[model samples]
Target: MQIAIRADSSKIIGTGHIMRCMTLAHALKNEGYFVTFYSRAHEGNLNNWLANQGMDVRIIPAGSNSIDQYSTAHGSWLGATQAEDIQATLNIINTVPDLWIVDHYGLDHVWHKAMATRSQVMVIDDLADRRYDACLLLDQNLGRKESDYAQLTNAKILAGVDYTLLRPEFIEQRQKASIRQGIKNIVISMGGVDLQNVSGIAFRTLLNSHLHELESITVVLGHANPHRADMQLLASQATHIQVEVVQGVSNMAEYFARADLCIGAAGATSWERCAVGLPTVLVQLAANQQIAAQQLTKVGAALSLDIGQLESHLEPVVKELANNSDKLMGMSRLAFSLIDAEGTTRVVKEIKSLFA
Candidate 1:
């Protein structure tokens, strides 16, 4: 089988779409299918990283008509229009792949219909906000239901956290994660592009604060982060806090495995944290993430805070979790129970079932 995925990542659009699609691409490739990506050459895009993974990444040059279909706020974030995009994509390909995976929000039924004549369509969505013409629709978010997408599309629906599409690393690392204890090691990950520099706010608040039980702190910044220098300087000042700013890390699951606690955006990585059973202080980087934070908090899997409230509430929240070891342990168990870390495998099985 041959799979071609159309997803974009940029400073404004963030990295969730391309990152999740990469999981499905990897799964298909591992199952002996040829998979390729068609990503826009947007600033802060991960086209290089996609290529580094040994996948053929066709870069679509971004221009005025470019777009990111999922984004209602920044509809033109893709740097091209829906018509321009599909035309550019078709121009570059030798032949259409067996399956066409559409993972963007900006393009909808109209866009999907245009591509329908080319190949079978599979949609990977989280918001369930728009209509799609799909052969398979997977929304792996917690609390999602077939009904949420019932009106939008009649595609075969795979909904909820049980089918969270995570990389194989997370599942393997979850098995090796240490038993829970007092929160000492803290990992701060603020999405792929922390354009607002929330990572700086988090670092200053924690390292310079009165909370002293923290043994070590690792802040993972994305390659797209414009403020890596700022993060590095803050880490240097926190000599007593055991802080380090890192980027381009391929082993995220390993970090989650060793860390006692995590402070991160409630994006796609939320599922990865849950898979690894890491207690989290979830921050809502975007409006879309609010529901994930809410659902995780509702189940005692994580503690949620809005970005506006982060500076004021982060210390108190971290301190409270630190003082209460049993609660942290319970949170770990709940996080672990939310998903079995077999999301990609399950998704792969279902994809194959379509052929069967």
Candidate 2:
């Protein structure tokens, strides 16, 4: 069996889609099926990173056609129109790759309908706004349901947190979930592309606060972050504290297990935190993230905030959570309860059954 994944990662377009798709792709690949990726060369796109995974990838040219009209809120990120994207994808796959798993906001039901003529379709989406012509639809967000996608396609829906697409590494490492008494050894990982440098803001707040109980702080940055130097400077200024700045991490599960408190963006990494039972101070980086962040917080799984509020209120919030060990434990329990860590296996079974 063969599958062709359509997803992109870059500075403007965060890596969440590609990362989750990679998780599913890796799992499917392990089952002896061939998988390939078709991505456009957007500025910070994960083309290179995908190549490093020893996977077959074909990059669409790094430019856009003249198409200003778009239907979805994030469609501008596509860099090309729906027709152009389909043409670009078809140009490479002269013989359709059995199944097309698309993870993009720009290409809606129109794009899916166009591609449906060639092969079966599965869409990975969290935004319940657009329409789709898919056979299977997966939305791993906390509050997602079949009704949310009622207006869209008549696809076989895989909804809610149980189907969260976590990588095998995260699943394996989550067996050693962290047990937290109080907030210590803080890990600040505000989105991979922290254009606002929210991690630096949190770092400074922690340094300035009276929270001396924190033994160490680990700040995670991605290759696309321009504020890497600023984070290093922040670490240097914290003479009384031990600080580690890790970039392009391959072992995220280990960090989550070791962390007592996590200040991370409300993206694909939310499930990773919950898998390791890490109580997080979630920041919504984009409009798409608000639902997951708020839903997680509503269920007592996490604490969500905006960048401005994160800077203004993070100190007090962290202090309160740190001093109250009971609250931390409760939150950790709720967070862990939100995910089973077997999402990869569940999703793979669903995919395989599609062919069977």
Candidate 3:
């Protein structure tokens, strides 16, 4: 089988979608499938990273006006323009693609509907803001609903945390990790793209709080972070907290494995935390994150905190949680029950069944 993925990774786009797709591509390759990626030549693009993984990458040059328009619409660093990307795909695929997987937030029904003509398309999305015209739709958020996309035409829904395509390593070590009461080892992973310098704000809050139970503070940043130097500099000067800023960690399972608790944005990492049974204090870094933040909290896997309320509310909450080890342990156990680390394997198995 030949699978073509339409995904992008850049400083602004944050590499989450591309990273997840790479996980899928690796699984498919192991099952004897050929995979290729079509991406734009954006600055900080992960074409090299994809190529390093042994996948062929096709880079399309962005049209001048289209790039400007898309950047203005999304943000300047959103990898590539949707119009230029779609046109580039048409020029390459003369025959119908066996399968086309798209992972982009800016792309809406218009883009997916147009691409549906050339292949059986599967869309990976977190936001249900737009309709899709694809054979399969995957949203790996904690409490995604199938009915959220009822307006779409003939799309098979694969919604919820179970469909989260995490790597096999995370699943393998899920059970061995202890979900017990202990001093809080906090993890701060804002997003691959922490545009607002949230880590600094969070760190400040932690510092202002007079709690002493913070055993460790691990901050995970992407190598592509624009503020990497600044974050590193800040970590160096931190006095009260034992801070470590790690960039481009391949083994996230280990970090999540070691943490007694996490303070992270509500995104793809939420599912990874759930898989490892880590009690997490979820924060919505963006407007799109609110739904998942609430859903995960409602499901008893996480505690949701809005970014708007951080200054006034976060310090107190963290200080209180640190003293309540029993509550933290219960949250971890509930999180473990919410997701199995074997989610990627199950998702791949379903894809194979679709092929059959």
Worst 10 residues of 3 by lDDT: 70-79
What are the per-residue Cα lDDT tens digits for candidate 2 across 191-216? 66888888888888888877868888
Best-matching candidate per TM-score: 2
Task: List pairs with backbone clashes in candidate 2.
Answer: 10-44
Total clashing residue pairs per candidate? 13, 1, 0
Model 1 agreement with the true structure over 43-121: per-residue lDDT tens digits: 8899998898788999888767645544444357656677777788888887688788888877677667888886888
Candidate rank order under TM-score = 2, 1, 3
lDDT of 1 at 201: 88
Q: Which 10 consecutive positions of candidate 2 have the poorest summed lDDT?
A: 62-71
* lDDT values, one for every candidate: 0.85, 0.86, 0.76
Q: What is the lDDT of candidate 2?
A: 0.86
> What is residue 192's positional error in candidate 3, in angstroms?
0.8
Give the poorly placed runs of model 1, Cα more than 4 Å off: 66-74
TM-score of 3: 0.89
Pick the lDDT winner: 2
lDDT of 3 by residue, 1-356 (tens): 88888887766677777888988999988999788887767667778877887888877665443453423334343334656667777787645568888887766566777776756788888777756778888887776789887886468888887888888888777867888477557778887777777876776676566767776788887656667787788788888778888887888888998988788888778888888898888888766678878887887778877777777787777766677778878888998888876667877786776689
